[model samples]
Every structure is written in C-alpha cells, then in structure tokens.
Target chain A: MPGKTFEEQVRQELIGLRLEPSQQVWETLAVQLQQKHKRRRIFWLLMLMLCLLGASGWWWIQHNTDLAPGHAWTTHADNSTATKTTTTTTTPILPERIQPDTTPSTVISQTTTIPAHQNRDKNDYAGTADQLPVKLLNRQAPRTNASVNQSGRYTLPVGNHQKSALSKDLQREAVPENGVIKDQKSQPIPAQDNRIKQSVTAAPAFRDTVVISEDSKKSVVSAVLRLPPSDTTATEKNTRSADTAALPVPTHQPVDSTKASVTPATQSAGKSGWSWAVQVLGGLGGTRKSIGSLFAAPDPLRAYNPIGSGSPGSGAGSGGTATGAIPVVRDGASLGFEVAMEKKIGPKQRHLLGLSAGYHFYTTQLKVGARTAGTLLFNNFNVSNQTGYYFASRDSLNYTNYYHFLEAAVQYYIPFSFLKANMRWHTSLGINYLLTSNGLHYDYSGNAAYLFQNNSLFNRLQLNTGSGLDMQLGRKKPVWAGLQVDYMLGNLSKQALSDQHLFRISAILRIPLQKPARK
Target chain B: MQDEKKLVKDCLKQHPAAQKQLYELFAREMLGICYRYTKSMHDAEEVLQQGFIKVFQYLHQYRSDGELGAWIRRIMVNTAINYLKRRPQYQLDLSFEDAHLHPVDNHQPDLRVQMKDLLNLVRQLPAGYQTIFNLHAVEGYSHVEIAKMMGISEGTSRSQYARARGLLISWLENHGINDKKDYYAR
Candidate 1:
C-alpha cells in the first residue's frame, strides 16, 4: 500500500522491490555447494578410517602376544631334548654357526669333565650342553676306534677308560691357560651334579674321548669326550675329577659367551629379530570442542512480521529483531612431543610395533553471545523471569589441558623405489592410554568463571592412526627420516564440550639402537 | 503456504529440484537487498550468490516461528554487512566530510521514475550512507540496532540515514519527478 506522501510511497516501493539475479549465480552456487558436500564426505571418510585402524590395532595386539614367542621357545626346547638323548658324553664343542675366533679350549676347560655314569640324566647338565656352541656331527674331526654300523655309516668310537684318562689330563693342563676363569673358588657346583656324584661311584669313560691340540702352548685344546652308560663306578670317579678341575670357571661366563656367539646368527635370520629403535617426534596439533546447548540461538520474536509491520517512522519496537547467539571458538596452536621405542615383527621386518609415551598441550578460547542487542538483552539463563541483562561482552574463557599418554602402535611398511633411494610408505594404528592428565585449567572472564566452575570434562584415552613416507638416511645408518600425518580418534572431553578431534603433522627421526652392519 | 514448507523440507534434504525452486523464488528480492549494499551490479551478484549459499548452509537453524522469506532476508542482510566489512573501501566511518555534506534539492519529486532509478540514486550515495539508509528505511532496523550492526554510535546511524535521505530526495527531485502523480499506480 503506497501512502499519500512521496516519501511514504518511496519507502513502500523500495521495500517491495525485487530485482532478478543473473543466471550464472545459481550455477556458481550449485558448484560451490557440491564442493562443500565433497569436503564433508572426505572428513567422514577420514573418521571412519581412524576407527577401523584403532579396532584392528586392538585385535592385533590381542592375537599375537601369546602366539609368536611361545611357539618359538617350545620348538627350541623339543630340539634340545632330542639332541641330549642321542649323545652319550657331554662334549661342549662350539657350534659351527659360532665364529671360529671364539676359543674352543675355553669352552672345554669350562665344561665339567665328569664321567657319564655319575652326571648322566642331570637336567641342568643337559641344558648346559644344549646351550653350548658344540657342533653336532662334525665331519672334519679325525676318526679313531671308529665303529661301522649296520647302515654302512662309520660312527665315531666312544673312547675307552684309557682315552678318558688322557682327555682328563689334557683338560687339567688346559684349565691353567684359561685366564678368563679369574674366580675359581667362588664358582658353585651345580646341585644336580653334586647329587649324581654322591649317589653313584665314578665310572671311567666307556665312551670316546678325542683330543685335538694346536702347535702353540697358548693355543686351546678342544676335547670331545663321551661317557658309557654301563659303568656307574667309573662314571662317578670321572664326575668327581671333572668337577674338581672345572670348579674354577664361573658358570655365567659360558652363558655370556654363548650369547655373544649366538647374536650374529640371530641377526642373519631376518629383520624380524628384535632390534630396538628410539624415535623422537615433535608436531603441531589442533583441537575443537562442540559444546551442544551451552551455546544456542537466541529466542525469536513472537507474532512479529517485517512485511506486515507499519512504516519505518511508526517505531514498531524491538519485536522481530531478536539477537541470536553465535558460537565462537578460538583454537590455539598446540605443541606435542614424544619418545618411543619400536620393535620389528615378522621375518621380512614388514611390520614395526612401538610403545611410546608423549605429552600434548592444547589451549582453546570459547565465547557465546549476540552481536547486536548490546547489554540490554535478557539473560537466556533466567528464561522464566526474562531478566534483562546488559553489556554483551566479547570476553571468553580459556581452557588449557596438558595430557601424557602411553600408546601402542603397529605399523606396516611398503617399500618403493623413489629417486634412486630406498623409500617406504608406512601405515600405522595405535591405541593410547592416558597415564595422567593435568585437569582443565579454566581462565574465565568476569561472570563466565562462576557459570562454568563446576564443569568437569576431560578425555581419558584415544585411538590414533597415521601414514607417512620414510626415507633411509644413509646406507650405513639404521636411521630414517619421515613425514607423517596422524589422526586421533575420540573427543577431548568426556562430558561437556565433547566431540573434539586432534590431527597432527610431524617430521620423525628414528634411530636403531644397534645399527645393522652394511653389506 | 504448504508448498513453501515442503519446498524447504526438500531443500534441506538436498533435493536438487527443490533447491532450484527455492533459489528461483527468493533470488530476485534477495538480489535487490544485496544491490543496495554493494557498489556495482557485479558486486551485488557476488553477494547474492554467497548469501544464498549461506541460506542453504544454515537452513536447518530456521525455526517455523517466522516467515521463511524473513529468515532468509536476515541472512542476506548479515551477509551484505560482512561483505562490506571485508572490503577496505566500503568500511563505514563518520569522520568523512562528504558524510556531513548536504545535497541541494532544486525540484519536486519525480514519481514517474521507476524503482530501478531510485535504486541507482541510492547506489550513487557514499558507502556509509547507503548502508545505514538500507538498514533503517528499507530493512526497518532501528538506529540502535543499526549502530550495533555497523559498530558505530546510534547518533552516527541517525545522522548517516538523514544525509542519505536528503541526497536521494535531491537526486529524485532534480530528475523532475512530480509528486502529483497517482503514487499507487505502477
């Protein structure tokens, strides 16, 4: 309705005016909306991936803990039992796998020269023999008093009592040359060895005793001796003599030597052998909290219409122009650092599992208020009475939460040729246990402190999944440099202001504790 | 009324045909509102596209308490204000001497001139005057509300609106539009 006056008519005309927009505007809006939809889809897809990774990681840890190491040890124990029953004399010869540089004379002098009848069926002796570096079925040794079996195979003779005496004398002479046996009196005789010698008389060796000597006096004498199962008296006498002569060498030295010799053999088995790595990672992180009804839109005006309302001069009051609340989040940049140890799994070293502890610090500022209606607007808290409030302040509450977590991760590597360098793509899944949390420190402005004082909200744990490109730093070094993008699953808060996620991009350096020797 | 509600529901579900329909229904009036705040037709079109995008984005926030057109109008006005604040040239200030300058009125109103002519005259005014006039006169926002929206004092808003009105009246009268014509006849 146009008024009589020119001004009123002008106002009426302008209020009702509608100018057509260009056709291209709709197409542009459509394309823009499509892109937004695509972005939202990508975000959800990433979230799904993180969830799957976490679930799979939890399953993997549960499945492998009891199976891998237990199976390997069982098989090794069975093999040791078979080897003990087939051989009569416990000659501690170094295994062929061990390096030749390790002195066999030291091992022989350390071994108890007890005859088989007194020390036979002793589990500790069998275990010690099993651990010895002695080579089984060595074809290189000289044959003396060889026995021909029905299968046409020549068996090495079990040395008689006289050979056993000669072997014992050689061992007694060689014991003085082993300077590594520094503490003779401190070495305690194994209880099993003492029990057998007390029950049975010494039996002179009914088995074979072969003595091999080097030209130099300093050179080690390797003696391969076996005791007969039949002569209990001779075995007891031999056990007593062997125990007296070998009592000077500490039992632990042999074990240490065995481990030192076994290390290279285990290393060559595969990359799957346990090699520890320490990683130092630093990254930037961002956090967001969705505080549901804590920030809601202001109530709309009742029974007010802009089109039906009178002219601008009529002073239609503040009826239809209600101020709405806008949620404003100021996410501060975060700094995070972690130290972790990783172990390779499987024969090909395709998977690396790690346990890491890290500290992450984040600060965020949150504010909810109206833009227009200054301070005179009613406080939404007192909805019943509609208490009038003023000064809609821009002040915000700052929350800083620092947390430390221990995380277990499993990663798979896909190696590819990149720029003539060995580069690998690593995908990992991890679960974090929040060890401790420095509770939310609320720094509120004015009235907000009183409003949010009792809010108890924090995250106890989270799941993380990441992928990165790792490049070997050098051929000689077991160090790797990588660029990683890690996505954490779960809310930062358990109750109020939940639904927060953390994403971190970091450059990582991994250094192996024992560097693999270069080929 | 039922058709409008159903169209909104379908648009919320991202039905393409419904989105096009809603756009066609509101694009014209929203464009007019944007045109009043921007400098050129091109700028107005840009603002209109962005404003419509926001409408669809926050459509779920719209309660059935008010008219859908009014809700969309509020969003478009806010979008225009945001667009002006982002551009350095369109920042509102009262210290400029031209804001204090009064255009001389020599002739009576030209009623024969169409609404487009009046919009052209409004666009010719300075950015500050144009925004305050649109918010106060056409959009029916009070001086207090306009002051808060533009981050200026209520006094500044009243003065700016007054200057804008004077300039528009002068421009219309100069074009020889007679006030004696039947105002209701288009």
Candidate 2:
C-alpha cells in the first residue's frame, strides 16, 4: 500500500475545499424556476398531444401494412406476414417503388462476383471508358430478359419483372454453381419501345428468398433483403431464385410508401414517452406567542410622539404584535416551481427525477427608528414624534424585493437495469449547484438599485422528493406525473425567524412518444 | 467490510460503488506508490486517477485466478511509470543528491517506529530510488520484471535497487537508530 500514511488526512483536507457558490443568483434562478414550471406544463401538454399523434400514426402504420405486390420494401422482414414475390426481367424499372431510408447499415450479401484476376485491372472495380459504358448504356433506357455475361458487370437498367422471368429461364439454361451461361434470351430491349416500369432512380437492394416452411395446405415464403449500395447501376442488380425446383417467382415491387414496414420503427414512433408536468411548492413558516406568555395587556410607553394630525395611530399596533419579554418571531412564506424530463424504463414502470430551484420573491418595507428619510426640523416639531424611519438597506435601497434560487442538475436513472412491475419510482442523489443570485435595491420608483451576492452556506443540503403518477398508456408505454421538493439546512438572520437555507417543491407529467428506429 | 467474492464481482461490473470501495481501500497504498514515482502530491493524484480509471474500464477483463487488488495495484504502478516514460525529460534531469547526511558516528534508537516509519523514509527518497527500493524490497518484483516495467536494463535496475537500499539504511543510521541489524537493509 502506498500513500498509506497520508491518504485519510489528505482527503479530509481536500473535502473541506469544496466550492459553495453564492445565493445572490437566487433571483435569476427563482424566475427561471417559475418559467421552468410554466414551460413544463406546456411541455407535458405538448408531449401528450405529440404522443396522441404518434400513437395514431403508429396504429395507422401497424394496421395499414399493405401486402400488395407492387408495394415497395427495403429490408422489410421482421415477424411480418406479408406475401412478397419478386420477378427479374429487363423492362424499365418501377419509377415510384423505392423510398430511401437514411439510416446506415452494412448489407452483407449485396455484391457482384468478378473472376479472381480480371479484377487485376484497378479499372475493373471502376471500369475504364472502353471496358463498360455505364453512362451510354444506362441512358439507353431499360430492357427485360437482357442477358448479361456470366463474368462481366451489367451496366444498363435490367427491367424488373424480366429479371424474375429470366431467373426462371436461367434455372433451365445454367447449371447450379457451375457458372455456365446458356445463350438464349440474351437480347437487350430497345430504347424507344421500352414498355417496362420506368426506373428513374435505383437503390442498391438485393432481394433473396428462403423457404420458411412448406405443407400441402400451408406454404410460407420469406424474402430476406438489405438496402443496396446507392451506387450500383439498376441493370447490374440480379434477382435469384429461392429453389431451382418449380415455384414461380412472383413479380413483387412494392410502391414507394410501403418501404417503412419495419415494426419496431412503427412501434417506437407511436407516441411521445415523456409527458410535460409541473409542481408548485408553498410554505408559511410563522412564529406564534403562547397565551400564557402574554395574558395581560401592558401600558403603552409614549412610543409615538404625535403632536400633529398623524400622532394618533402611529404606535406599536401592527397586524401581529406579540407582547412579551420572550423573543418575537416574524413569519414568512415562499413559492416555487419544479420541472423535469422523464423516460420510461419498463412496462408500466417509469423512473423520473426533477430539479426545482426557487425562493420567495418578497417585497420589503424597511423602517428606521421613528423617523422618515429627508427630515429637517421634523417639518415643524408637532409631527416629529409621529414619524418612523423607513429606509431600505443601502444594499437594496433602490429595488427592495428579495428573491431566492438553486439551479442545474444531473440525475441517475437507477431503474433501467431491471424489469419492475407497475412501480414508477427512481431515487437519485445529486448536488444542486446554485447559480449566482441577485438582491434588488429599491428606489422610490421600485426599480433595481444594485445587486451584490454570495452563496448561502446552508443551501448545500439534499432537496429530496418525488412527483408524477405512474400512468400506463396503451399496452406498453408508461406515463408518470412529476413531483419534486428541495430542502436546504441553512437559515437567515436574528430579527427574522428563519435560517439561510431554503425548501422548494414542484410536479411533472410524462407522456410516451415515438422513436423511428428502422424502415 | 469488503466481501471476498462479491467485491470481485462488483469490480468486474465497474460499479461506481466498487470504484469508491477501491479508492477507499487502496488510495492510501496507491498514493504511497505514486509518491515514490512522482516529485509532488498533485502529480501523484493525476497518476492515481489515470490508473484507477484504466483499472475500472478493464475490470471485466480480469481473470479470476489472481488477487484482485494486487492486479489493480500492478496497473497503478505501471501507469505511474508510464507517466515518467512519456516525459523522458523527467528522468533525464533526475540528479538530486543530499549533501548534509554523511559521516554519521553514533546510533540513537527510535524503538517506537516500525513498518510505517520505514515506509515514510522510502517515500522521502527521490523518485528513482524510491520506486526501485519499494518495488524490490516491498513489492518483491524481480529485477527482470522491474527492468521490463520501467523500460530500463536489468543491471540499471539492480544497481538502482542496491543504491536505494543503501541510502535508506544510511538515512536510518544517520537518524541515530543504529540497530546494526541491517534493519533498513532490504
């Protein structure tokens, strides 16, 4: 073991150096917290609407998967029960059949085989101008039943259904695995009289068939496909037969809109999974005098010298005046909001965490001992005793409203590793780093006079609470309402009853949304 | 409070809990290792964090046949040495000798000190000698292993190891604790 002698002692020293930021930032953070609550409500409401829209879209997709032959498909096989038949022939390719998906994937089998050494010419991979005129031949339009040489790359658009018909003929013409080409059906279709589907754009997709199961009463055929490379010419693509025996190759080219038949893509995209939610926190921390402590009313000291018309009601008679040698306690209350982002981890199970930073934005009225500001000879001594000093702290003389705050946080979602049932709970422990806060100085017009701030030492405790209901939407999605609270252990000064630390609360709502994963 | 099997399992998963545990358990020892390799405390921390992060990322790759903490400690020492390797200039100018502690005569015994005192003396040695002395005397790695680890010849490692031990013993003898037991003698 190393550093054995110094580890504990050094760690203790380092721990003492932690940064506790200032509390003057509470005003900005307080306002931001309030805005956050409003935004969260709006967010959840929008999330709900988005979820409804996405769910409707997903339902529409799940139920509307078309099995028609001309509907298009790009890697579209996953527990799908659609019947697909692909034909290979030289006719102009279908123009409106391919809807290109932007996701990148490695399609293993979409390759053109070349003789080992003929590829010796670097140009073989990208052939020379004389070797293959893809530009000229491709412009010649598309043809069906066009025979490509066994070893040579085909440059023109091989008509769609013709590829299917030609494969049928190829079973008779060429022997299996032998690389032998029979000479029939080798003629290309003419440019002017092309009656095939117009394939203006071609995606490098190869469709292959594997027989899943076969019975006299039930026949199951599957076409496993991948998105073709975007560069390959339409004619160079081939349609191969599932078996050489005797099944007809159906000419199936799905329409453009049919490309996104992947179920998870549709399922993930049905609804917004997190909903917008909000919570409000309010507290009235007050002080009371026991009846036993102040049972009798005492005589008034000539506390107010009222020689003028204002002399009568200027005594110690406010809304709350506890009479006793016992300490007087002033009560105050604070309001705040909490907003959050939530994600579901399991079926009917959701884990959510929220951050809410706020404090009371209270208006202050300062009083000096029996004297008002800008006083001369008491404006003729009669009303001199009737006056009380009313001055905001020099620090807050211009804008005298006090606000509070806390901000920026990160949460650890612990429920992601397990499959919990109906329990939408997540407990996270993190530091609520407070931003810089402001103290408003009040002028006679009540504008901000100036601001000086420091981090409240007592603001460094855990603000812990839970909000949001665990809602189960549809069959799988989970929705949770958001609620949260914060507790700081510090308090303010003497004449005021509370400490420097603060507490806050808020709520949230989660809605399910869609994620388009595959097409 | 470390569990024998469960600790290994949790470490393998790179759980943050396991990381905190590893830190609490070995930070002291690793810091000693680091102090032997580096000139300053801050540098030692940098090396420690680097080594610990590597140990965590590769925890799953641990084959369960060996002691888990030992395996991680080896990684830490290597990481510390690697920091020296990248800055060859650190080794190039490593010529600092104390001129004041020579020609000591009598012996004063400090019987209150034990293994901890000797370890502190090892830490106060210069980086090169401290690392070699600790590896050979405490860690029990062979000269060949030390050579491969520090990217130096075995003879240099041998000579350095001998010199480190001689310096430690000489320091103790000068401190007046002459047991003549070759007590500081590795």
DockQ of 2: 0.01
Best by lDDT: 1
lDDT of 2 by residue, A158-219 (tens): 23543454334323332222221111222221211111111111122222222221222122
User: Candidates' interface RMSDs, in order?
Assistant: 5.2, 14.0
Candidate 1 lDDT over B126-169, as tens digits, reads 88888888888788899889978878777777778777777777
Q: Is the docking of candidate 1 incorrect, acceptable, medium or high quality?
A: acceptable
Tens-digit per-residue lDDT, A75-98, candidate 1: 001222222212222223211112
What CA RMSD would candidate 1 show?
Answer: 23.6
Q: TM-score for the second chain in candidate 1?
A: 0.81
* Root-mean-square deviation per candidate: 23.6, 26.8
Off by over 4 Å in 1: A1-7, A61-519, B92-113, B174-186
Q: How does chain B of model 2 score on TM-score? A: 0.70
Measured with C-alpha atoms, the lDDT of residue A444 in candidate 2 is 18
